[model samples]
Target: MPMKASGAADLTVVDRFDDGVGWIAYPDETMQRASHAVESDGQLWVIDPVDAEGVDDLFEEFAEVGGVVVLLDRHKRDAAAVANRHDVPVYVPEWMSGVEDDLDAPVKQMTDGVGDFAVDRLIDNPFWQEAVLFDGETLIVPEALGTVSYFCASGERVGIHPMLRALPPKKLRQYDTERLLVGHGEGLSEDVRQEVRGALSGARRKMIPLYLKNLRGALGI
Candidate 1:
């Protein structure tokens, strides 16, 4: 069964790994987004915070936050707010140095990858940027992949977010994923490997229309 937040009406434990790593969902009208936390050495590390109003209360329920990681440049979201509240450092991708100007807390560049965190950068994307974080047997993806439905008694559905499907496939096959933690929609805890393979292989055909639409917007045509 999924875990529930004490006082926060918008937060829910959408996915929990076997080692206590989990992600919370904050759903709005248009999309259901998520932020991840990992417990290691009795400390918590948050990734891509959302809905700042109840962050402190949420953190109190979990372990004290020691750090924050921003996986995508555009996904700064509430990282700075959470970092400030906890007096922790924020780690961002090196290429996205411009984000430093927008953040209020001390920022560190993840130049050599997040040490010992098992994160791998998905190179060769033409649309946007992101990294895949591996926590034990779980795979936490920032974007380019995610679920678009809610977890139900039947099961959860996994897919590539429409915007990211435009990009080519990454080196995702190398990882042996048991569970998937996404930044949007519901997290997948069953049949993860097959779902990922389906997204990587079959999404290209579905991407063509959206890719053309994006191209038109870029050209203002």
Candidate 2:
């Protein structure tokens, strides 16, 4: 699928935490794409950034951006553009080494961890590859996990992302996740751990159908 251009002027702050962690969402057709910024050690770090015209003003409100981190290879999104503007390094997961030849900023390899955050490869699929970020208390997931669909028939809009349902679940029960930050949708502030487990359980049974749907979506059929 072709990448969607970011409507930066349409970006808005959708969620904020007490620790200066914030999630921003920008329109992309009928759905919205999201990114996150967190304050750590007096600097701000952006994850899966989308290009925006007011990005400088946004960063100024937070602290100076220290760096940018890309969790999924396809999610490089506007990381290079944003990093160049800030003159910061762009960190990509070790698994995504050769996918960034077109990036303008300096790229660094993220090994087992970066700063105080640890990486967890949650999906084994090559096409739908993703990793979760554990920052001691919060779990930040890429496209592999989302709370936008009610696929589990829960009435509430929290469940596994359709594209990731075919993948087996990772053992994420150990994390004391107080907050759940996702790349494509809204963040969850309550009962995040339980919601994640529910999504995983729901995925196992609905895998086949979800896989077919995801494949069609990817093929734009």
Candidate 3:
């Protein structure tokens, strides 16, 4: 699907903590693709960034742009453009495959992590290879979990990706995260770790129901 342009005025801030900020450049869409600017060691790491006019002003708090990170294989959203603008390498997790060839900007492969967050491989298959970054306090999940309506059913705070609902990434529950940031939608901050556990534990149980709900929405029933 084609995406629209978002100028400075079109941007809406979603998640803001002491060291990171998440914004939605396309707020009107269902996907509500979110981008983040996380500060670690005085360097700002832009994750799955979608370019917006004057968006650079949001990064002024940090001394310099450390890198642009692409956590999910398909979420190369504006990384090259953003990296080129800041003259930083677009950092791709070393374990993630089939992504480096698509990038135009300079590429730096991260073996362990970027900044204070440690990278963990969540999904690895021929079709999809995703990674999540976390420090004890903040969890940045590029996919496999989200807060959008499509991702959740009734009474769900966070949810597994519909495709992975049958076998959700249960290991995410191990993190004692205060804030849960995602690539697709607004994140969770209040009681986030509990919410993540709930989502994972209930994913399989709710799969069929959620699929029917999505089907109804798609059919406008």
Candidate 4:
């Protein structure tokens, strides 16, 4: 995927809900790198943020920036820049390591939860460490699941990450997710439970075909 800096003109607001708004900063990129600003207790918590020219304007009605949250190790994606801009610390889950070391802005390790969302550790290997933020109503899955075309299968609205499809994270199946927010593409508001369940249930069954499909796409077949 091509990585390029985006300006205000490139920002596209998506997944606008009652509690938060998501923005795609790099829409041209294959990844469709998305960022979220969730309002809890009158404070806006930015997640996996990608800095854009007028991102601050979206938070105007949501109250002040509570803090910036980084859910996955590699998704540092302008977190520090956004946190520093708002004068809030970058909140990394306590279990997630190495991410704080990479940030230039102030870092605060979250122990129990950040704002109203509780941290649920999804993957914890040496190479990848990720967690999802769930608050009974909203589910912010950073990587384990997404709505992007590359992440989903033939008729799926949400799909397991290609790397994790073989042995999909079963822990995610526990939640009856109402709203699904992700780091890539856009968030899902309708039929979230059905979409999430179908993705997990069919993940392994669809793995081989999906992998070959992605490989073909990569080779421009």
Q: Candidate 4: what lDDT?
A: 0.89
Model 2 TM-score, 2 decimals:
0.82
Name the weakest run of 10 consecutive residues (lDDT summed) in model 1: 148-157
Tell me the TM-score of each prediction against the true structure: 0.76, 0.82, 0.95, 0.95
Q: Tens digits of per-residue lDDT for model 1 on 1-221?
A: 22222235466665655344444544542356678776655677788877546556655656678789988767888788889878989988776545788888899877654434665677424446677778557777877676753211112266666655656455776668887877776677788888787777666665665456546655668
| Candidate 3 lDDT over residue span 111-175, tens digit each | 88888889898888998889999878889998899998889977998889999998888889788
**Candidate 2 vs candidate 4, TM-score winner:** 4
lDDT of 2 at 164: 51
In angstroms, the error of model 1 at 139 is 1.2
Stretches of model 2 off by over 4 angstroms after superposition: 1-8, 21-25, 150-156, 206-221
Of 2 and 3, the candidate ahead on TM-score is 3
List, residue by residue over 99-154, the lDDT tens digit for candidate 2.
46867789887777555678887664556566778888878887766654323334
What does the lDDT read for residue 82 in candidate 1? 80
Ranking the candidates on TM-score from highest down gives 4, 3, 2, 1
Count of steric clashes across candidates, in order: 0, 0, 0, 0
- Candidate 1 Cα deviation (angstroms), residue 60: 3.5
* Residue 31's lDDT in candidate 1: 50
